[model samples]
Target: MSPEPTVEQLIAAARAGATGDDELALLDAVIAVTKDLSSHADEAVDQVVRQVRAAGHSWTVIGERLGVSRQAARQRYADRVERIREAAATGSVIHGRDLESSLSSALAAARADGLAEAGTEHLLLGLLTDGVAAATLEQLGATRDKIREASHRLFEHPTDWPGGGVPVFSAEAEAALAAARQLANERTPDCAPIIVNTPQLLAVIATNPGSRARRVLNHLGVDVADIKRLLHCYINVPRTPFGRRSRRGRGGKKQRDRCSFCGHPRSEERRLVAGPDVWICAECVALCAEMLAQPADGGV
Candidate 1:
């Protein structure tokens, strides 16, 4: 049997401009294999890198095409390629052709059904097959019935399809996903799956009353505060609380500071300087002073 091409060999070939028609054909084959494994474009590129290395493409040429130095390309993709190989060897849940087929079929079903968005419902349905995600869902106590109940609550009405319409991206879905992507990009630019999932969609709905999406999010244990944080991070929109003072500074005036304990705004009371970061009204100060004068444990 022929010896496998070393990383050094691949880098040398790529740098030497020796990747001719035969090499290109080999690269194309690798690309095709990778595409068969994943519908994502990035994964295709990853597969090409692996194939080129296997076919003796040099890291220098690979890095050149990838817009990175040979060292950088190797550092970034070498471990990933190794992981892919390891996964293939270990019969991991996420590896093999079966999982890919399941994803493709599930996506196809959602598309054929005319779903406008790909939510957790679609993902769950897709996971009905024996895949890594499915295993994770099962371990997480996600059953079809639970998912159905959550979906119904999310939609605010029981229906056969909780996530309605073709799985194609919708303006609303795209906006949400874009917002998530922007936030993720700020934090981790190379993050995958820029789209928001059903869990996120539901959480947003739950935070905002009368939001179908929020209901879904609530059902999934994503509370209003979490949603608010996500919105703050991604949408740049603060979640204003009901009956709370606005944070926006009004003309040159300091924003109204409220008492942490009583929820009383500074405008409502006579200011008493208790301590640094501890402003209290005269009435509250008196009350606290009186309470302090009593026995440490007998104020009740």
Candidate 2:
């Protein structure tokens, strides 16, 4: 593959794209391009650093790889890591592609109705686009048209309001989004990254009392609790393994005593039963036995 354009090449291109004989304009354009490049570079480095950190690398090792001092590396990236960690804890990481599409659809729905702002009802309608939210709503007989109609009838519309400008989210919609992010963060396992997908958003919208979304669902004769209950079926929050450790042995060597099922090291308290090419720990064996003991009809 060819190399990416250098800063000089990008600046030259920016200058070449300038119109008339305007030195200030050309300089501004070059500066803008430079700033943009710098921002993109910072973002790229931050993302790579985050991935490296996630992969269990320390500041000393990362600093060595970057040809910098450990303290310098930590000082540069530690704040960014802390910011990300705080955001994750507070459920601010809600920029998933699916959720973005739903937000777009929500704005479109608001615009279609000539509404000045996209309300939580519009967000609920948008969740019908795809994913677990759509399937769950469909199962509950909450079609897009039905929701739109119900929202139209239930929510208030301004009589003299002009909807020419882009529709911003209503306060309730914003609250719903925040709630969804919190729900997703809370439901996600510690081992997994938090993501505010359609299901989470939809559940928040449906469950929030006095919201336009909930009102619309009520108008359509659909129970809000049903949305929550149905969503639980689609959400899987895996538990963190007890006493889980690396599959590697001392000095980063591969361990043969690791259980093939859970990848946990075999300890004195938890011995492993070995087969031809697989190993099962005592916990996994007990789990398997319990599962097998269940009747064919799910023990009902």
**Top candidate when judged by lDDT against the true structure:** 2
Q: For residues 1-300, what per-residue lDDT tens digits would candidate 2 score against the true structure? A: 011222223333345444533443343444444443321233334444665686677898777756689999899998876665666566456355556777999999888888878999899888876555776788889899899878777767666656579898999899898887777666554533465677778878787778888888888889877876655533333223322333565899886576654556679887987643445578755644443233322223
Worst-scoring 10-residue span by lDDT in model 1: 1-10
Candidate 2 minimal-lDDT segment of 10 residues: 1-10
Residues 156-275, candidate 1: write the lDDT tens digits.
322356554446643543454444334422322121212222222323323445433344445766445644432232222222322223444858677666542233566643564443
Best by TM-score: 2
Give lDDT per model, in order: 0.43, 0.63
TM-scores for all candidates: the values are 0.30, 0.51
Candidate 2 stretches greater than 4 Å from native: 1-92, 158-161, 235-300
TM-score of 2: 0.51
The number of clashing residue pairs in model 1 is 19
